[model samples]
Target chain A: MGDYALEVTNLTKKFSDFTLDDISFKLPKGYIMGFVGRNGAGKTTTINLITSLYHKDAGEVRIDGNRAEDDKVLYKESIGYIGDESYFHEAFKIKDIVSIQKDFYPTFREAQYMQYIEQWELPTDKKIGEFSKGMKVKLMFAGVLARDTRILLLDEATSGLDPITRDEVLVMLQKYIEDGERSVLFSTHILEDLEKIADYVFFIEKGGEVFCDYKDQIMEAYRMVKGGTDELTSELEKEIIGLQKSSVGFQGIVSREVGDTIGDKFLVEQPAINDIIVAFQKNMGGNHTWVQ
Target chain B: MKIVISNHSELPIYAQVKEQIKEQIMTGVILEGTKLPSIRQLAKDLKISVITITRAYSELESEGYIATMQGKGSVVLGRDNDLLREQYLRRIEEALETAIETARFLKLSNEELIDMLGNLIDDE
Candidate 1:
C-alpha cells in the first residue's frame, strides 16, 4: 500500500525472452500520468501486471491502498482498464458490450454512455467485428468512461485511432477528470499524445524506470543546448546527460545547473518531450535505450 | 485565421502556441468573445503539454490577445490588427537586422545579397 491511486514497487516479471526488471513508480490520485516508452519498452508488461493479467515474480502493487492480490476482483472493480489490444467478444455488438460492462461496473452511467454513443457516433447496432479499428477504440473508451472507475489504466489507447477519434477520446478523458479524484496511467509510444494531457511523466526503458517527474519539473530542469561541434569539449559535453552531433552542429540535454558552465555561446532552449526521449536514449547508447 | 507553423521552426512550444492564437485573433479566425478550446483541448490539438499551453494562454491574456474564464475556457479579445501588424513587423525587422549584420560579417555585397533574396523569394 502506498499514498497513491496506483503504486508498484520493485515489480519484476520474466518471460522466456524478456524480463521486466525491478519496475517501480507511482501515480498520485487525480494526476494524469503518461507512461512513456518505445515499443517493447515494457509499457504493456507493466500495465498487465497492474491489471493482474500477469502475476509479478516479486513486487508490491496497490490500487487505492488495497493490495492488488488481496482481492483481485475487488481491486479490479475500482479500476477501469483498456489494454493495448481490444479484448471484447468479436460477435458482440457494441450495444451488447455496453450492456455487459453495465453489469460489471456498479457506478456505470447509462446516461453518460448514451451521450458518448451519440457524441462519438458509435454504431451501437453493429457487431464488434464489423466496427473499424477506430470505431472499436471509441467503443472501448465510451465503455470505460461509463464505468466511472477511480483509476483508469490505458495501454496505447490511441495507437490506431484516427486523429479525430483520438481527440474525441482525449476530450472524454478530460471530462472524466471533472471529479478531481479520478486518475489515469496511460502508456503510449506517442510522445505527442503524452504532451497533451499528462501532468506527470514516467519513462521506462529496458524494463526499468529511467525518468519519473512532474511535467513542469522536467521542463524547468533540463534544456537543449545547441552549439557548433568544435565548441563541445569533453568537459562541456559531460555537463549534458545526452549529446548528439550532426553536420550542422551538436544538440544535447544540459541540466540547468550547468547553464553557467556552457555559457552563452550555445543556443539554450527547452527540448520537447520527444526530443528528451531521444536524448535519454542517446545517453544510454546510440542504439534503442530500453530493450537489449 | 491563417496560422503558419514551421514544422522545423526553432520557436519554443509555448511561443508557437501563442503565435498561432495571435494570428487567429488578428486574422479573424477567432472573433472577439469566441470561445477557444480548453487548456486540455489546446494541448491535445497542438500535441503539447498543458503547462506549455497554459503559459501560452496566460501570455496571450496578459498581452490582451485572449481572456480565460473558469469553465468557459480562453476567449479571443478582439485585438487591433494594427497593433498585431506592428508587433509582427518589428520582429521581422529585428530578424532582418541580425541577418544583415551576419551578411556584412560574411562580406556579402549588396548585389550578391539582392541576388540571394531574389532566389529565396522565387523559391517561396
Candidate 2:
C-alpha cells in the first residue's frame, strides 16, 4: 500500500527471448503515466505483469495500495487493462460487449456507457467484427471510458490510428482523467501522444527500466548536445549517459546543468523522448544493462 | 489551407509551425479577420506539443500577422500596409545578411558584390 495508484518495486520478469529486469516505477493517483519505449521494449510485458496475465519472477506490484497478487479479484476490480491485442467476439454487437463487461465490473455505468457510445458515434447493433481498425479502437476506448476502474493499463492503443481519430482518442482519454479518482498507465510506441497527454513518463529499453520521471522534469533536465568530435573530451564524455557518434558529428544526452557547464563550445538542444531512449539504448551496446 | 513541412529541415518545430501560418497569411489563404483554430485544436490537428503551437501563435501575433484573445481564440489580423512594408524591408535585410556572409567567404569586395547584385536584379 502506497500513495501511488500503481507501484512496482524492483519488478523482474524473464522469458526465453527477453527479460524485464528491475523494473520499478509508480503512477500517481489520478494522473496519466505514459509507458514509452521502442518496439519490443517490454512495455507489453510490464502491462501483462500488472494485470496478472504473467507472473513476475521477482519484486512487487501493488494496485490502488493493495498487493496485486494477494487479492486477485479486488486487484482485477480496481484495474481496467487493454493490451496490444483484444479478443472481442467478432460477431458480438457493441451493446453485447457492454453487456458482458457490465457483469464483471460492479461500477460499470450503463448510462455513461450509452452516452460515450453515442458521443463516439459507435455502431450500437453492428457486429464489432465488421468495424474498421479505428472503429475498433474507438469501441475499446468507449468501453473503458464508461467503467469506474481506478487504474487503467492501455498498451499501444493509438499506434496505427489516423491523425483525426488519434486526436479524438487523445481527447477522450484526457477527458477520462476529469474524475480525479482515476489514473491511467498508457503504454505506446506513438511518442507524440505521450508528449501531449502524459503527466509522467516511463522509458523502458530492451526489457529494462531506463528512466522514469515527471514529464516536465524530463523536458527540463536533459539536453541533446551537439559538437565536433574533436572538441569532445573523455571527461566530457564521462558525464554523458548516452553518447552517439558519427563521421560528421556527435550527439548525446547530458544533464542540463552539466551541458551548461560545458560552455559555448557545444550546441545544447532540448532532448525529445525518442532521442533520450535511443541514446540510452546505444550507450548500452544496442542492448540494455539492467539497473537493479 | 495547405501547409508543407520538410523532414530534412533543421528548423525547430515551433518555427516550422509559425512559418506555415505566415505562409498562409502571405498567400491570402487564411483571410484577414478569419478565426483560426484554438491552440489545443491546432496541436491536436498537427500532432505537436501544445507549447509549440502556443509559441507559434505568440510569434505570429508579435509579428502582427495574428492576434489572440482569451476564449475567443486566435484570429488573422489583416495585413497592415505598414507591416507589409516592414516585412519587405526585413526580407531585404535578411538577403543582405546572407549576401554579406557569402561575400565574406569568397573575399569579394562590397563594390564587386553590388555590381553582381545589379546584374542579377537586371536579369530578373
Candidate 3:
C-alpha cells in the first residue's frame, strides 16, 4: 500500500487499430495531475482503464491503495469517473437523475448537489435532452462532486465548457482537494488551464508515455529556440527536438541542458505546455531525453 | 497580502509567487509573526496549482522569510534574522545601483543624484 490516491502501474491495453503502451504514473493525495496528449494518444484509454470501463490487458490501477480486483464495491465507491458522456437518460430532469444516482453513491450529499446546481444554474425543470453540451458537462461535474469520491477521473470533461465555466470547474477541483485527502486526474487538450492548475502533467504520444513529472519540472525541461535561417547550423539542428524550418526562420524545442551549445544569437524562450506537446510530434525521431 | 501574478511575465509562476511574498515580507506589508494563508487556500485564491504554492512557501522558508509549523500553516519570520537583513541590504543596493545608472544616463552630477534621493525619501 502506497501513499498515492491513484496509482497506474504499467497499464497496458490493446485494441484493433491501436495499443496503449506500458503507462505508469502515481498521483499522490492532495494534488491534480493533467493527463494530456494528442487526439489519438491513448489519454482516454488510460483513463478508461483507471475507471475500469475498459479492462486493461496488463497493469494495475490502485485507488487509494486498493486494486479493483481486491474489493469491487470499495474500489468503485472510492473513485468517480466523469467523461464527456452524459450518463443520463434523454427524458430525465435534474431531480430524476439525482434520485437514481442517490441509489448508487451511498456517500452522496444532496445539499452539495443542490449547491452546484444553484451555482451553475443547471435547470432542474428541463429534460436532460434539452441541455446544451456545455450545460451537460457542467451537470456531470455537479453530479460527480456530489458523490464524495476520493479520486476523480475526468476524461475530456472540460472540452465543451466555456472559459468562465471551465475556470469555475478548475476552482471546484481545487476545492475538492483542499482537505488533502482527495486527488484528481484530469485529461484534456486545454493545456492553458492545466498550466494554471495542474500539479503534475502526464503527456503521452502515439499510445506511449512521453513524460510524466511535476508541471514545473516538465516546463523546466524544454525551451523554445527561434533563430534565423542563416543561424541554423548542423549542430544546432541536431539539438532541436522537433525542428521546423521556413524561408525566413526556424523554431523548435530544445533541452535546457542544450543551452550552452546554442549560441547567444539564437532566441531561447520558455515553451508552454501546448508548445511542448505540439513540437514533440514534429520530432524526426532520435531525441529521447524527455523520458522520466 | 495582495499578490498580482502576470501571466505575461518572463518569470515562472512559482518564482513570481515567491518574489511577491518576499517583497511583502521585506516591505513590512505582512508583519512578522502573522500567519500566512494555507498553501491550499492560497492556491485556490490565486487560481494556481498547489505545487506552485508549495514551491513558493518552501523557497520562502529556506530564505528565512517564513516558517511552517505543525498546526500553523506558515508564519512570517522576524526581520532581524541575519539572512533576511542581508537579502534586504542586497536588494537595496541593487535598487540604488539602478537609480545611479539612470542618473548617469541623464548625465546628473553625484550631488544632484544624492539631492534627488533625499527628495524621494522625504516624499516617502
Candidate 4:
C-alpha cells in the first residue's frame, strides 16, 4: 500500500465551459481531508474522476498506489463512494441491495452489514423509495462501512440532513478511521461540518486549487482585521485581501505576518473557515500559493 | 475529563485541547498517573480527526504533561505547580501589556487606569 490512501496529481478535466485545472492533493492514511468549494466549483467533477466514473482529460488518479487507469477493478474496490443522491434502484429493498452488494464486492461482509442495519434501526423489508432522506443516508453509510474499503470518497453526503443526524454521521466517520488504516475525502460546502472532523482542507475555487494544507496551519496563516475607515492606509490596503468597506467601518483579511506588522492599529482576530473561504474567493485574482 | 471546544474561539482546536487538558491536570481534577484516553479513542469520542488528537497529545508530551508508553496509552505526569504558576503569570503580563498600550492610545492617565483596575477587582 502507498503512504497515501488517495493521491491525485495534476488531475485535469475539461468541460465545454468549465475546466478542472491541475488539481492535486493527498489524503494520507488515517486522516480526513475536507474538499471544500462553492457550488459548481468542479468538486463533483474531481470526485467523479477519482472514482473513474468520468474519464480524465489528463493527469493521474491513484488509490493505494494503483492508478485509476492501470488497475480499474482494484482501484474501484479500494474506494467506497457516497454521493449526494442515492445510486441504488428505488424499487430495491434493503435486503435486495445487500445481496447485490455481497455479490459485487469480494470483501463485502454480511454480518457487518447486518450489524450496521441493526445499529441504524433500518427496516430490511422496506423499499429504498419508502425511506426518508436521512434514513437513506444512514443505509448508504451502513453499506459503505460493511465493506473492507480502505478509502471513502463522500460528495455532499451531509448537505440536507438535520444537525443531529449530521453529527451522528461525523461520529461514525471518526469511529471508522480509529484503526489508523482507513482514510476519507469528503467534499462539501458546509464549513461547520468540516471544522469538527477535518485534519487537512483542500479548497477549490473557480475550477482551480487555491489552498491545501492542514486545518491548523490554515487557521494560523490568516487573520481577520477590523478597523475604522480612518485606520485604512494605502500600505495596509496593499497588504489586506478582500477588503470591504461600509458606512461605519472596514474589514479584511491579511497574512499573519502583515497583521503583526500592523500591531494594535487594527483589531486582528482569528478567521473561521467560512470567513477565510469568503475572503479568498473575493481575492481570486491574486496568486494562489499552496500552503503545506 | 470534561473538555469544551469552541469553533468561534481564536485558539486552534489542538491548542484548545492542550489548554483544557493542562488546566484539568493543574487543578488536580486529573491526578498524576491518571491514564488518559488513547489518541484514537479520544478522537472518536470527540468526533474529531485523530491527527488533531495526536497533535495535542504530542504537545502535551513535549511539555512534560503526559508520557506515552510503548504498547500502552498515555498517562498524566506530575507537574511543578510553581512552574505552571509562572507560566500563567507571564500570560497575564502579556495581556496587561496590550491593555496598557490600548489605554495609552485612548489617552487614559496612569491614575485613571489604576482606579479602573481597582474598580474591576472590587466588583469581582
Error of 1 at A25 (Å): 1.9
* Candidates in descending lDDT order: 3, 4, 2, 1
Candidate 3 structure quality by residue, lDDT tens digits, B1-124 = 9999997776888999999999888889999999999999999999999999999999999988998998679999999988788888888999999999999999999999999989998999
Candidate lDDT (C-alpha), each: 0.76, 0.77, 0.87, 0.86
Query: Candidate 3 chain A: minimum summed lDDT over ten consecutive residues — where?
Result: A283-292
| DockQ (model 2, Cα) | 0.07
After superposing candidate 3, which stretches have Cα over 4 Å from the reference? A260-263, B89-124
The clash number for model 2 is: 0
Model 2 per-residue lDDT tens digits across residues A192-255: 6777667788888889877787765676677789988888899888777678788888878887
Worst 10 residues of 1 chain A by lDDT: A283-292
DockQ of each: 0.17, 0.07, 0.68, 0.58
Give the DockQ-based CAPRI class for model 3: medium
Q: List the residue pairs that clash in candidate 4.
A: none
| Model 1 misplaced regions, further than 4 Å | A1-3, A285-292, B1-124
Q: What docking class should model 1 receive? A: incorrect
- Candidate 1 vs candidate 2: the DockQ winner is 1
Best by DockQ: 3
The pairs that clash in candidate 2 are none
Error of 4 at B49 (Å): 3.0
Model 2 chain B lDDT-worst window of ten: B2-11
- Point out the worst 10-residue segment of candidate 4 chain A by lDDT: A283-292
Backbone clashes in model 1, listed as residue pairs:
A206-A290
Fnat of each candidate: 0.29, 0.07, 0.75, 0.93
lDDT of 1 by residue, A228-275 (tens): 988888877766766778988988887766764565778887677787
